[model samples]
Target: MNQVIRNTALSAAISLSLLGTARADDAKDIDTVVVTANRSAVPADEVLASVTVIERSDIEASQAPDLLSLLARQAGMDLVRTGGPGQTNTLFLRGGIASHTLVLIDGIRVNSANQGNFDFAHLPLSQIERIEIVRGPRAALWGSDAIGGVIHIFTRDPSAGYIEARAGSYGLGGLNAGFGTAHVAIGAGFETQRGFSATNPAAGPGSYDPDNDGYTNRNLSLRVHGDVGTQHVALTGLITDADVEFDIGETAAINRELGIVLWGEINDRWSHSITLGHNSEDLNTPDFDSHFGSERSTLDWVNTFTLNADNTLNLGANWAHETGFSESSTEVSFDEGRRNLAVFASWRGHFGTQTFELSARRDDNSQFDGATTGNAAWGLDVNDSLRVRASWGQGFRAPNFNELYYPGFFGFFAGNPDLRPERSISQEIGVDWLATLSQRVSVSLYRTRVRDLIAFTSPTFGAENVNRAAIDGAELDYHFEHGAFRLDGNATWQDARNALTDLPLLRRPDRKLSLSGSYRFSNDAALGLDASAYSSRPDIGGDLPGYARFDLRGSLPLTAGWTLEARIENVFDREYQLLEGYNTPGRSGVVNLRWNGK
Candidate 1:
């Protein structure tokens, strides 16, 4: 813990020193537009919720290896990886459980119905254009599984063509290429690595493994959009397949998504959109002879009416069908299906400097009772430089197939036929200050109470609704850009505990801090530093230790359209563990060469 604190302080000092020596330049004003904060496009600065927008430029500049690595820098997020690449990745948002957050790709839900969580390990950075993270409860507009918040990933769009190849430590190598015309684009990527042992030998005799674990992935995506008369239409498809080797078993997974969207203006005051989508996953464990498959098909139609310059009305209806299936060599099996129909509405009113938003949703499920959620928020812009916002919302997470229908094996493990969804109510207040054109700051405070949490307990060792949680949290985010240097940082403090036991939630650190800074050179080259620290937290195995890590990145332009990028991760050779029994990556470097068609 002392070492962790020292490292964090050193990182802060480095960032501050860089800022002091940075060249003075006029920072450009970028007005980020986002849709996840609301169902419609809105300026990020005007949104009432805590939101983070990560663009393609930022993604490339950071040189992060995967989606999980990039998301770990954000506030209010706790990431736990069981091992190296291709391992089990779990994210707890706003101190909520791993399954409480909703994940979407192009507005289509992708979480598995069996486990109720989406794996971020296989989502490559090469195919993603941007990511929008909204913190706090969003179920009022998005429905179940949004008790924590929402992460919406937008795939790459048609733009300049590019191709790249990379090689890193631990026998890591990959290729990524993309090409696009005015209305169509395609992207493909392949990655393979001989990773270190996933489980540490010190954990236990049963978990000891000296051999290396290997991983391989192949992914492809296609996107097309065009204007047909007065309406715009888009079609998107993505597929990914991955194979992973563990100590005693091997697993393979295939994931797919398809979407068709159409939208257009009906008049000066009204516009509408229709989206049809499908997401599915098929996973197999060869050594265990186990298989799990899940799929979700959805339809959504939304209409927006501009009542006036200061007011708007949004109405939408959604329908979805989900199914899950699983089988194991132990003669255990699970098969279940469910359907949901939902209707939602929201009203936004801007009165002078104060803005008001109210949204509600009702989800009627085939297997359980209906769930209704709502959100009310108000924001006030004070003299154009300061803003204050407050909001209250209700959210829920439905029971997954494994918790409700899994068949007992060897008279040991069982499932409860009767289970209720977990529910939560949350409230938050925030303040944003644009101290200057080159500096901005945001602070937020929140509290949440959750009830009817599912847990496996004594008696039958089956799932039951017997737990509750109380979470209180705070966040501070800062951004500064002066001339050729830029800095961004955030700090999070959360107390997430079980109400009955007063125990800390698993793998949720009580404190987290991150800092990222970059300096641009006169020759068009750039150097960046990324550092983070996390406090110790309890895991299933035991109390994991606190740690800190740093990464160095740089890029240089070469001939014509070619460029070279490189990153040295774990610059200090800091040893850390996100999970109690899993080993983490050590000092490693990756070099990438790319040719752009711009």
Candidate 2:
């Protein structure tokens, strides 16, 4: 693992140096982006953090069905799943525990209060406008569950008209359409996938047939936006339904979710947004003689006020209710509720040649014993090409209902009403270099020390959640574009160990790397290639072998408004497993046809 990390780092350094020299002669002019990484929009090059932005065009070109699959290919990140589709998928950032990472949809927390993690598989790709990933400690800005990093998903607000229909392998079919006028806009999309039974635990030898076990998922969404006199108002609603069955066993599950969001600009300096959502999951397993279900409803509101051109203030509050009933033979019921409130403010401005940012937040929760959390961050741009950032914060998570009350083999588990929230403190520093107009490179180093980390231990029928570990890592990213071709690469090396045992964390890889290049043959044709590698993963009780995979994609414009797209994944047919007892799909091909009304 040490050798691999050293080699990759050396290679990245060499590449960056070479690209810097070549960039001076053939550089193209492009606009820099301003991101809200510190609760305010600042020049991307001036931020002392490592960040990656995936634009809408990049998402469309990837041809992925969901955000999980798309982000899995990114460097410094690892994705694990138990099966081909509809299975639980987890994301690991910078070698942190899956639960340590935070996911946000339009600034609304998406992590489940009961599950302890977010299911990235359920997020629809059609509704996404862009994604901004900050690959390091961001707890100072986001508060809790951000000990590792933060991934913010932004949904699309139609600015143009488009419609598309596609069908392919695995009984997959989809319809995506949207329209936007000067004053108003509306859009909707849907997708279905017939999943196979490759990972059925109860399946016999021949029962592993990929076509036998079938699963289907459906999603629908609607978005509307218009101006209310001098104020801009927008509303978005989405509904998703998924059903899956295992062919070898009489087990099935169904999930449904509905979400609505409202946001608007109340004048130039004031704005507010509110979101309401509900989700339900029902499962039936004759093999285990268990039938269970759960439902959750959430309401969140945020208000933003510009105290001036250089200072901003934000206030947010949320309430959630979770209730469910389960039955095996006799009937048993359960009910749980949680509420959270947070207030935060930030300031950003320039003092001569130096730019600075500062932010602080406080959170209060009502569940598993009420606790208050706070966070703060500060950053400075020393010069046009150098910046420094540091942050410290506290974050916590409450115990879930299942962990507190559930029936076990030996006895009935007891709920611990006195449980405490898990907490962590994090710090990071980074440097950004724009060697030339066409070449940019960034490196960031971060470390996080956690206390009362959540975990399940033996010796009792009840839960024992504890945290005792530290995670440290470094991230390197480079981007170069010249003429009709572009190249981008990113790599990360992380070390997460038990504070007492000094043992590596389970399921977290020590190294990750990704590289991609794209070239435009002409005004109507383009080709792209991507590759990724992972190392230092621990198997059930030992180390697992590492592997790499490659993918190729191309596009051809056929006519004025028509185009054809093709993609080949796992071109070498590499055999690897991201989840134990589950097999990944072999080589596959997909072709799509698209049209632009504009």
Candidate 3:
């Protein structure tokens, strides 16, 4: 306990030190707008939630190879990869399970119904315009699978035409091209890499693989929008096709999302929007002779009323139809479908220097009992430079198709038809201090309790809701910008444990820290450094030792509309593993040549 406390204190000190030492000037409130927090556009500072926004500038500055690598540097996030690129990847938010975090692409749900989770391995950075991460429960606004929070990805909306090509170590190569006009934008990217062996013989003979693994991916994104009279309409589509080679065999997967959205002002105080979306995934594994797929169709209608400058009301309804199918060599495993309908509402009021919000939701599922969730939040503008907020919310997640009706696996594992949904409650309080226009600091503390967690245990190896979990955590963030230099840092400390056993949850570290800085030269060139650290974590084989990594990146102007960009990853080349038997990338370098056109 002493060690844990000391480590937490050390992490906090590192983060707070940035704020105290910052010397910046002429910093202005950016007033970034976010939608995932409330299902409607709200300024980030005004929303009473722990949110992080990764914009295009941040993405290019880091030059991360994949979405998994980029998200790992954020606060309250942990990631596990079974192998190299294109392998199984899982994301845990706020110490919650992979399925607890809901992912969205342009307001369309993309999680597979079979596993109730989205794989981050195949998602490339080329197609993303921005990412909004909201930590903590959000079931009051979204229907289910939001115990941890939400991650919403917006597809590329290029403002200018650009083409880029890349080459690096490990036989990596990629090409990306994009263009935009008044009403439409399109982007395409292709990448391939020769990766190292995925498994280590130390784990077991079955886990040993001497041959090299490889990954290939092709992706496309499109967006079109226009204003007709007083109504605005937009259509977005994204698709990714990937093939991965492993020791035994190979797997081919495809992910696709499409959505159409329309919004219009109904009156002086009323506005409404309607979104129709579809998401689907297909995976095929020739080695196991298995094929699995899932699809979801959804519709959302939201109405907003501006009662006054300081008060508002939001009402929304959601409907979704989902299906999952699986088959093996000789026979079909399971083919099932389900439907859900939900209605939600929220009220916000501001009185003096205090802000209050209350929200509630009811969801009816075809296969399970109806669930109701709610949230209440309060905020105080203590002064011009200080603000405080607190929030409490309830969340729940239904059993996935695999956990409800899948047949036994090799006579060892089976799905239980009679399983209950997991439920949770979370509370958090936060403070934000605008020390100066160019310097800001924020602190948040949160706790969550989850019940009826599903697990496969004991003799039968069947799924059962016989477990519980508890998580307590704190987060600190600092940002500073002075002239041509900028700095950002964050620290996270969490105690996520199994309630019954009192053991730390698997694959989730107790402490995490990240520090990043960047500088721009007068010639439009830039340089950046990113550093991240994590504590050891418990897993099936044993405890995985902690490790730290650093990456150096820079961009240089070559000529008009031409630039050179490069990154050196794993500067120290520290050997480490994200999973018990998996291998991580060593020191490597990548360089890119990009051309832009007006």
Candidate 2 to native Cα RMSD, angstroms: 8.8
TM-score of each: 0.94, 0.84, 0.94
Candidate 1 wrong stretches, greater than 4 Å:
1-31, 329-332
lDDT comparison, 1 vs 3, better candidate: 1
Q: Tens digits of per-residue lDDT for model 3 on 404-494?
A: 8888777657888788889999999999888887898989999999999999987878899999999999999899999999999999999
In candidate 2, stretches whose alpha carbon ends up further than 4 angstroms from where it belongs are 1-36, 137-143, 167-171, 179-197, 200-213, 246-309, 315-330, 409-415
**Model 3, runs deviating above 4 Å:** 1-31
Error of 3 at 88 (Å): 0.8
What overall lDDT goes with each candidate model? 0.84, 0.63, 0.83
lDDT of 2 by residue, 424-473 (tens): 76777777777787888888777878777655554564566565888888
Over 325-356, each residue of candidate 1 has an lDDT whose tens digit, in order, gives 89876654977899999999989888999999
Candidate 1 clashing pairs, residues 3+ apart or interchain: 25-483
